[model samples]
Target: MSVTLAVNCYERTYRQVLAPGYFPAIEQMNARTFEQVIALINNVGDPREAQDRAAALVDCGEITGFEFVSDWVPAALQHWRLGHRHFRRRPYLLDYGLVMPLVSSSEYILGWDAETVLEEPADWVSPSLDLLGSDSRVLHASLNWPPARPQDAGVEGDAVARVGDFLLSWGFSDQVFLISRKNMLATDMKTFSPAAIARHAPHPYTFEFRMESYQRASRKVRATYEPVRYRTNLQIDGVLDRTGKSQYEGFRTEALHRVEYHITRQLPSRLGPRWARNASISQARGTKQG
Candidate 1:
């Protein structure tokens, strides 16, 4: 069955009057929440391995990650009505959309355009938000006075600008992504990551922005901010393969998946979605998900 998109409950209003001093509190709370979820993910397996995966990305010139906060926690999954598929379904975070971080991801939120989905752990962009730290935050910040139009997205740049500018003012390494409907449009900073920026092809000087940091300046300045913490029940699911059991009792799932990808690679003569029309790949051949 297809999942419907919910109206975003988290309003984008916080940006208009977002004061400079508020970052520490937000970051502290977010980091702690992220860490707790990481602990849960660790309990499921080797957190060190996950961390190593994140760290290794730094070496490979890519940033990879898994969701930190998950629906698996009793508290976290209070809102999740469904979970990702395994065999009989796995335990998942309640708020799988925002809290989960990438596996092997240290700072999972930071990365380039190519790396965003390419380096993302699994289904981050497809059916899930996975994190709140995205370029959309900037778009929300910018569109402060409108019902919002479709073109506003394209006319504007890809997600981050003012928000990134604000983060830069605060002195922390910041990266943001704002892709929707699969690269229909976007605006990105050249200096999103210093490490990655250095690797930019065709000589680095051409990129428009410079990467900068705030927390690393001095111990006294860093130690001054008080950290804020919030806790939510993180959903934790244990995934196990079902082996060769593709046939089960209970309710059956209709064919909701498109053979577009499969047909593209497996049968060049068949143009997936288009071919599906000729093939009549409809759910239940006539019935629908009810």
Candidate 2:
């Protein structure tokens, strides 16, 4: 059976919360390579994109090519003028969702364009997706295209294009996002009595899980990350026979399954009881893309 991923599309942009001084520099850095921009953003004392944005003010007339942070850039704007802004851009999808049995078990692929692709049909999928490793997490990758830019061409394009191609080729988004629910036995579920249900003790402050066999495509990059999930589950309220484990298993199999994904996903959230009220967006359930 094809596994349905818990989440499908993912996207991101230069959010202000991720940076403040970014507004002004946006114009200057717009002239340099995106790599140079990212380098400056990574150099802040606090390592936050906000501080690194300070470098954006370095226009052409102010600084020369020699003053960049050890090959980070050509001082954004040169002394000559804004110099045609050469922004390095790649493909990116703004929205997508997934249908997974559980948040943690869900997996989705992210294909960032690489500097190049093999002359022969090699393991592009392996190279692009291995970033997720075995552990689940949302991946928004940036592929490298090269031969050093104009000199030579690289992978087909950005992560977005590759992902779109995969989707088109597969005719569906199932395999890319695989999902499986972890069965929890009713016997194992120690439910508090109805009397204490409303005010039950908090879910003791703690959550940890062990990961095994985590792997990426190449060069062994070891990293750990928790995956994204949704808070959707079919609520069942009825007495259980508990007479036999097999019967219980059968019951679970027959019951409907509730799906979940990220917060911005299709469904809706209460969010303090005052959001999206009186709006179609709030009342809708599971918005789908044609």
Candidate 3:
């Protein structure tokens, strides 16, 4: 059965409080108390006033404990920590606050074109892609690795190609971009240990790929292709290490790896003149390319 809650409550509690920068903590409460708290927060006009009221409930034993939400923490750090926990076990109820929206929106795209899905551990690709249904097409997939691979020639290309071939077997004609650093430097590592060497290396490149699927020429070919345009950003960036030494002392940085696949589907043929014109243009291009 699908979980259902009041829309306003979900937005205020989950989306607002649990959003990046805020850490939401709630004490144990029964259904009635939970609803009351939600109502109280909803009635308040100022964010700080709402927080203060919620804290008051804790002091009165109406709620056991609660933390006023604050945006002091970085979203990347929270996502990274949550990612570690997600891999260890099933996602917690709070984690659903983030996952549900992602899954829901991807499932909702019926027309108009363009959708992006980001996965942390490459393992999420299959399950997330499975939810896209048959109408959407994956344009590209990227895999990132720390600069710890053996210095063998063509290893990166070979690894990426193997993954590309695997995706092809899954009926996707998507391309794969592999990003990894080369020529490791001694200064990049804190120790000579294998684990440290592997963990501390930075990414070598950043790239973005966009793919568009156009209608086919013949009726037979048209049945196989969808009118959609997709754009994907697969890149790496330097992230500040919050636990590292202060700025005055010299801050530490780490690589933030991301894999995003975007899917865009065109409107049905009967939608409007605009779609009809675009489809015709796309078909001509497809025929010429073919």
User: How high is each candidate's TM-score?
Assistant: 0.22, 0.16, 0.19
Count of clashes, each model: 37, 14, 1
Q: Write the per-residue lDDT of candidate 3 for residues 1-290, one digit (tens) a residue.
A: 11111111222243343232221122111011121122112222365655665565555545333322222113422532433333222212122222212222121211100112222312323322242223222222233322223563222321211222222111111222211111000011111221111122221110000011111111101111111112333342221122233343232223211111110113343332122212222222112110
Sliding window of 10 residues with minimal summed lDDT for model 1: 215-224
Listed per candidate, the RMSD to the true structure in angstroms reads 21.8, 23.4, 19.9
Candidate number that wins on TM-score, 1 or 3: 1
Tens digits of per-residue lDDT, candidate 2, 111-204, equal: 1111112222222333224433332221222222232236432232111112232310101111122112221000111221211111111111
Best by TM-score: 1
In candidate 2, stretches whose alpha carbon ends up further than 4 angstroms from where it belongs are: 1-122, 129-162, 166-245, 258-266, 269-290
Show model 1 residue runs off by greater than 4 Å: 1-45, 55-72, 79-88, 92-95, 98-245, 249-251, 254-290
Model 3 residue 2 distance off true place after TM-score fit, in angstroms: 19
What is the RMSD, in Å, between candidate 3 and the native fold over all Cα? 19.9
lDDT of 1 by residue, 114-162 (tens): 1111211222222112212232221111111111344553212221112
TM-score-based ranking, best first? Answer: 1, 3, 2
- How much lDDT does candidate 3 score? 0.23
Please list the C-alpha lDDT of all candidates, in the order they appear: 0.21, 0.21, 0.23
By TM-score, the better pick of 1 and 2 is 1
